[model samples]
Target: MAENTAERIDWRQLWASGDLARFCFICLGILLHATNETMVATVMPAMVGDLSGVELVGWSLAVYEIGAIVAGAAAGRMTSYVALRTNMMGAALVYSAGALLCATAPSMPAFLAGRLVEGFGGGALVSLAFVSVERLFPQRIWPQLFGVISAVWGVAAFSGPLIGALMSEFLSWRWAFGVFAAGGVAAALACLAVLRGPAATRQRNDGAPLPPFPFATLACLAVSVVLIASAGVDVTPLRSSLLLAAGLFGIALFFGLDRRLPAGRLFPAKPLSLATPLGNGMIMVAAFSVATVTFTVYGPLLLTSLHGTSVLTTGYIIAAESIAWSVLSILVANTPPERERGIVLAGALMIAGGVAGFAYAVPAGNIPLILGCAILQGGGFGIAWPFVTRIIVTAAPAAERTVASSAVPTMQRIGYAVGAASCGIVANASGFAGGLSSQTAAGVAAWLFLAFLPLGVLGCLAAWRLPANSASPAPA
Candidate 1:
């Protein structure tokens, strides 16, 4: 199948004839997930103030991501066994319940529980959204459809924090949670209305029992994340180092156990090997994700402390990255086949330049330069992501297409989780653990971004290695 449809298909005609209602519902799943993430991020400070859980604040994000990672990994297989509509509706309901829990929680522990549940649902929503694209759309429209989804994320980037801030300031942070719950309920109903029948499932039953859940691997992965997250707290240096090491060991063990599993493996064959296109593309995704985590996780704090920027301005600056991504993705979604490899390589370079730009601009308190760098960084991902995703999905064996589709976002999330932890270690080592004074904040901002430079370089190398023709058949 030709991955590039620009030469043959009219995008306008495709949209005119396509099921817009179903597409909108599909996009809604991811929109809600993305919006809720930024909203929670915006409102967290207020939540902490009310709940009095300053010390346990980090765990809120940690637990949510841990749940997301696990649920995202499982979602592909789950869809194979259950109807897509059923899975999506159930996920939306779970999300709604979690939001209600958050709105009513009086203590930090209760709030953490809600976040975990919310993470699981949000993770499933995102992964399943990709799967829906595969199942619902013709191959020719895949890139354009992905472009639309990217645009939705761009919209969320602007609105999520605004809604969160508004709720936090006037209506109370709890109302923010209530609002998300309402969105989830609406999304659930949309899923019920739009998705129909067994055709939405990944595979038809052939009288074989459903495979056992990958419980052992999931447990290992979850524990690994928890350990790494714990290292970020005010622990002793020796203890933190030990925790990180242990966490890495657990991750290694997970790969080994997953490889041996007879069924329901988390990834495709030789998924970690760089020899295959799928593996290489995934590595590129993960490496770039790790490299960018410094900005998403710490940009607001560093910008506010060093540059004296308002919270809202810092957020929009950070959001410039997503805006750039959406714009660039829409521009190149239908690039001619011959131009893709060049675009991918160029995008990777742009990302690396953006990271380097941040290393200088952020610490120096140059807001215009910082914003410009953000656009470059986001634009880089925007340019390359659709192509990278299409390549990875097409290269997977037919039986594993669902897994491959989910794995892209799953890997990105895992990268974020791991990168956040690694940054925590670096921050502690560089005097950020003591709290951010102007001097300490400047030093931390520089080193934090500089630390990820090598990862970005690795991503560039991986992008270079991607096969020139992305539409080649999956390797046996």
Candidate 2:
């Protein structure tokens, strides 16, 4: 047990190998997505000052999620027909174009369109990167590599706010996007130079054409998020209730349609059930994702409004979570296979505690407490997520590895969509829509974090139900 627990790899070997370029692209792919997301989110408060979008914030996020959902679903199958290099370059170019559009957008509607496109491209990049990990890296180092991926977000934690503030305060919020747009372009060029062949090179051995795109499934996902977002924008007794239900139904419909499809499926078999490890893992992912995102959608605004915090400070405060997530993930990266189940469950408990911590801390207007809560939340996910991901990937049918790997981020976005929409509804109903004030801010802050407590609990339960054994690591 000691030997297994203490075992370590020559981490430098990862970058020393011929696969280094592929790995760099993979990291770049995530950085492109994470940095854009973080920067935009950081600058949103200032952006709204230039544009009238106080109410449309939820919709803005939801549209991006819709685009991401569509892109994530199709990215897996695209590899069957297109080379990974080409697909990555195309996705990066799309991201660059979207960022360019946003940088130049004059109206809120145009901004929304730009965000949708960015999400589509970013989602594809991330999904493809996930697939690359399975294909390019040895399984034993997955935890370390996943830590590296989390570390990218940690870098984003600092870079996002610093750059976002520099542009939003010193220049223009639009220029911030212009810089990141250039990054997407650079990543695209890198992809062109580095990667080769298709993602699932082994899967297409039968030499058959892939199935048609699942347009209906994508549409269902889009509509569901729209309805939920609409409910958040206009909270009412009957209207909001109906919209929420319909939105959830749309998600269920998407799964049913996806399962029935002959190909181009988004998730593994029995995705909605709890009987299988994949199902539990999915539920845990969705639940925890739903539980945590309220911080993202509402955290900065609330902090600025309630506490008179600077926008830059608020951004970093939010970033504290990402940093903690990275630090803890890297610390726990060496966990042996035998310890995965316990660690996952422990992480889930910590996550639940973090949400509860936010419930108390955010409303109380304590910066230190809020930051602590964020660390708790992020740290929990950091320690557990790689293991949870490994569990899901291992439990997945051999043929569905690509789909399963990609599903992690897809599920996270779905959960974020739901969480963001729900936050809007809770905030609006708490009189935040009336306008920001001390009393209103307190109410919104309290409910926004509290409302998701059930989701945290659900996450814990789902984690508890996950399978005990993970796939054995390859020999070092």
Candidate 3:
């Protein structure tokens, strides 16, 4: 009992000893990346309207997500070759350039190119931020730091839509991109300042030569996303089916090849299985992400068509989950270790319930119910995410901690890409491709939400399987 008590974290003391300014700067990096994503999602409709690229709008998100996933996977190892400060500053610069390109893009193709570039930088920024948490802070403070980062995402959820809508409505959507570009610059400058001196030297000394890039896996993943995205376009059923099959096969190939690789691997061993703590946590993250992202990808469109909801209102509704998640995470960030399993289970239930509720709420055109469901879903993730993250990071071998930390976001982005594509398929098949009418939108909503319920169930099972015991450190 004495030994157990001694190991418990003292949050206050940890914070007191920490460098607040440097932590803030690290949080800022992630905030900028998160805000850019939400802002683009909000402003995309206006951009498409003005740019006359309704058909290419989905491609924008698809390309960005694919680029982000690839970059995130590579970032874990990339940091090994470069100093964290140098790497982060370069990524921020790239993000700024991409935002500038979007601000001035003359056509959809150009805009898509910009999005891809933006995603690469944004993805690296996020993954590197996670890695920084492991390298910079003590294990005891991990939950608090993760909570702070979640708070930043919540802020983005609240502000991103409002900022994007205001810019698009009162000024021009181009101004929104400009705003994000400015944020990138600020993040870059902050990284330059805070990540210097002894800390910078420590990071560089710990790093190693860059390993081989996962080119084959990257190619497979990229092609899969492309095929899945292409299937969403107005196409014959047979062609769409073939595209979907090809994409699934590509994904299988990626996993197969990834498992065969010895050292320079993209994911941890048994990444998709529930047999290990890291694998269970990652699989849960992926499954839950896939189930929940249906709302983000298609909720706004369906609600606008069926319920006559304004774009701004729909954005807030979609963001309700983030708000709930942030609030819940802060409330439980310091939960005693003994209660971690309970929280995980409760969070999983909330997510599954929320997903099930959305299936009915959207088609019924019930605004309050839809918002409630969103809150439930978001709250669930908030409760579970920190604990899962802690387990995965702590369980990894010291040498692979960066890779393990980065894999959480990598899995999440992969899940988002796949979920978005899956939703597109269901929507098109359910008469959404013809037009965005109330009836078609409702049909799509029903099919989309229902299809994802199985994923939610699988997520719950994974969460339940997580070991109650603190994960043992991997063999050195």
The top-ranked prediction according to TM-score is: 2
Candidate 2's C-alpha runs over 4 A off are 1-27, 79-86, 128-154, 191-206, 396-402, 436-439, 467-476
Candidate 3 lDDT over 185-299, as tens digits, reads 9999998878865545344444455566788988888899889877877857799989989998998788788767656677776677667877788889989987887777667
Report per-prediction Cα RMSD to one decimal.
4.3, 4.5, 4.1
Better of 1 and 3 by TM-score: 3
The 10 consecutive residues of candidate 1 with the worst lDDT sum are: 52-61
TM-score of each: 0.83, 0.85, 0.84
Q: For candidate 1, what is the lDDT?
A: 0.79
Number of backbone clashes in candidate 1: 0
Candidate achieving higher TM-score, 2 or 3:
2
Tens-digit lDDT string for candidate 2 (303-336): 7678877777767776778887878888998998
Q: How well is each residue in 306-325 modelled by candidate 1, as lDDT tens digits?
A: 77665566667766777788
